[model samples]
Target: MKKEQQEKSFTMSGEKRSKVYEEEAAYLRNRRSVAGTHTTDRSGIAFSGGGIRSACFSLGILNWLERSGMWKEFDYVSSVSGGGYAVASVLEREFDGEGSGKTRAEMVVDKLRHDDGYLRSKSATLFLLVISASISGLLTFSPIMLLCGQSASLMINIYPRTVDNWASGIFCAASAVISLSTWRMPGMVGKLTLFIAVFFGSIQVAWVTGYLPPNLRVGMGILLILSWLIVLGLLGLGLSHPLIKRIQRASFLGLMANIVLTFAIVLHLVIDGTGKTHTNDVLACLYIVSLGLIFLALLASPNRLNPFLVTYYKSLQTAFGNGRDDAIWRNRAQQGDPIHLINCFVQSPRTREEPVRSRGGENFCISRFFCGSQSLDYFRTATWSSGREKKPVWRHQTIWRLITTSGAAVDVHPTRQSPIVNGLPTMFNIGLCSWVINPSFKRKHRKGGPVFVLNFAAAVGGNSIKQKWIRLSDGGHFENLGLYELVARQCMDIIVVDAGCDPEYRFSDLALAMEKCRDDFGAEIDIPGLFPQRSPGRCHQSKFEGYIRYRGVDKPAKLTYLKLVVTEHHSMRMRLQSSIDPKFPHEPTRNQFSTKAFVDAYYQLGCETAALAFPVTGTVKRAA
Candidate 1:
């Protein structure tokens, strides 16, 4: 029955997929005609991801393109990460048609210049996130810790305690250690250790409760054994069967039931208060502290809050004056602007059928009309925020949220199945920067309730994909260039703005994009001038022209690549190098609080680089 339901949900016919593609193509064509930019071939511009550095630099490129009347020629604009920041600003202005007689780029620069202390604002937001998580954990765990500690003290001081009871206690602790230590081991060893642990733990529970009244002792012991058996059975099914991963949640539910039962025992003992002593008090205090530490460790999962306080929302407020009030989606749908594709990655559990090009996840695209990926197929953007039950909820499917989700650049981790590298940041609550969203079709209820305790449990509790929630972070995690989607769309011409940090000019991001496009879409991208000799003393030429050939297309597409580098000498660049850090263009992306001069320097450098590459007369044909 369960398999049938899943099959029904994912029954995407080949005709349906083709229709989706055709519908999107027709929409793009209509949009181009409406904007008076229709051509025989489609064109797109891609902005690479690199936090604020990419945003400010892309703004400069847009300024020049708009001034030269070249921006309106494109049919699509694909942006990822920080590039989305600049694109969002442009869309905001275009939608509202209210820039106070200033160009969109100029207005954005002015707002950024006024609020130049970005670092301070970012730090305050991070501090607030940390403090709130800390307080929440303390308040949620204190009572449970006290109850468990008191119950343990009572069990230890039970009247007429025998050697068998003490032995059971020691054996239980030893088994628990062995169970936890060997949980990750493969083959029969892990299963055997777990079985031993559960067996001994159940016996210990029965033995420790022997001091209770005869009827109550028997009933509690029987209940504990049954709960353990049920949990163990569910675990066995989840591991042995491939189609019933959802049963994993049932196992957790069984474990939770056992916890509740244990809590009941603790509450009863604390109320009885027959084993009160100074030593017991000290032991309870120590247990509470230990539990507090555990809760703090679990607070690392930041699903409760969004971390775009300064980077995204503040930028929106600066650009539009009112961040959340603007109807970005509605405006774009009704206007003739290019189709905006905010590229993001959905972190999903890896399956054997998944293509190697997916890395560990799938490419999730958020556009004005549709939202989803190849794996999930497409869904209407208007109805996406409607909960799984199709009920209206607080809509999170907004353009600004999607843009921020695309630019979620910090605290990223691999999927749950992969071994976590550099997990310390996640443990320290730094992973809060990643955004969690509802899946397109399989959206589940927000796990847990309003209570912080239950919410914390849900956040850190299970690592099952059956939960049906989507984890989205920086597009850079999968592909930074934002070129994959354009290739997927099979655009005839593309201009890639490479603002990503590449001081060494290795072009790793570009290489990754090219490789994925070739492997996934059978699209070959070749740029002869992409590789140049590295020289520390001189600036490398930053513009290159290339061509791409798709698998089934008869005509190859033209590719123009623009990188953010100091290709030509500028007065602002010289001033910045002399006064501020020498690595003006190649500064670390962490320098979010750069001064107005810093912004102007990058902006000017961008304009000058674009001009030198593509002059007014258009004489330059390739990289110099």
Candidate 2:
């Protein structure tokens, strides 16, 4: 009886043990799931909070920094710039224990106030920007001139083959020497002047030669920018001692210089490629790519972009630039070279103060409208072509051939269906780029009326303002000599955007294609005009007054073809104005509102006036 009782106790004990083990196992599994979920949520919240805090803190600091009037000091800055002035002043008191140690947010604020770091970093930065700018100035001309000399000489055109001489060891060594020696100069300005003279002067030299092929010439151009970046990188790594402010200054200078140089390099790369080759296919990255390209040396944090990867990515981008569609290569064959976009400034009355002279044609009229140092402005020398060409013969797409008829001759190739003109793409040669005189003239007003010339012997009779008298010749203001070349090269026609304004169908140059607060302002919305009834070949004359832009996403907003700008203050003043009727193929949509859309609209608009204004009419006097 005792043995049986003992056995029963043992069985009960075993069952209890089994149940406890199972319960423990279940609890452990459940805890894992719950803890994992909580951890994920916490991580996400932390990141979100940190980002918000950083942004808010940065904005507050940025506002104070901007208002501190530090930027004004740039003019007085020598090679050692004190850019960190704003941050230093704010942090000076806090660091001395005059104020509280502060919270994390407060700590960030205080860190920015630390003037020493700011000055060190900033001083270095100033030198860098100036130097890099100088380098870019020099580089812009180096290769093209070399190529031009090669192009002119050697009975045969050996320029392309000799392009390998562009990035040779000598150029790199010379760039290195200039970069190194400039740092040792007495003042930053002197160093800058030296570089600018070396570089800027060279660009003129190259432009004067005007025979180098721009596309292949880009190889050396890129290397020049890279050389500065390399020198700065080395400086940053070598200089970090506390007493070595000069080293820091040089490092910072290298970094800042590279940043500026990078942007210039990118800009020139795009412009040189586009203007000469007519290939704007590459994406323009003004900030991020530039930031990554240059600041990798001075990132000062573990969480940063890798230098190797950044280098690789830049190389990839360059490769892509070299790899535009075959069509670009084909076009290069026909165009010979790019037409430089020489910037010309003029008086408001339309006269050039600085004339855009030819490589050999020295001395240009000075135009006062040009701001900053006139030295910074660029203008192109128009190649005096007789406006005639050998008919291009290359392959074309059916769609391409259908669009243009202005070419001397467009022929389809045995290969692809894309049309070719003079052995290049027909799209450019025959594409319509129409110009029009002021299209916003109204019949009733004469007192405060827009300026109109008197006794203009134009084929299309001028709708004269009662008091004003200026007759347009070929719809040209003739302020810029380069304008003549652009018009001739582009095969532009005069477009009559407005012959007359309809009171009911009033027009404004601004396209109110999209707007905010649609429900409140829909019916009243009109396009803010970026253009006016500009005389033929007038580029963006009215855009300065006011230009409102919108995209297709604001489809609900009601916009008319009118370009409405309020000139006079009036009660219930309807500033409604109209563009030519049938403004677009259909009403503007989001698809037609971006930068790309605007360019497309421009091309399409160019086509419309070809038929309207290309037909000649006899001359007439300015109407009163």
Using lDDT as the measure, which candidate wins?
Answer: 1
- Candidate 1 runs further than 4 Å off: 1-19, 95-101, 117-119, 122-127, 136-312, 319-322, 325-334, 349-358, 386-391, 415-422, 432-435, 442-466, 569-579, 617-624
Tens digits of per-residue lDDT for model 2, 56-167: 2222322322233221111110000011111112222122244432322233333433321111224554455455434332222222223322322211122433443343
Clashes of 2: 68
Residues 161-191, model 1: lDDT tens digits: 6675677678778988998999779755875
lDDT of each: 0.62, 0.24
RMSD of each candidate relative to the true structure: 9.6, 34.5
> What pairs collide in candidate 1?
none
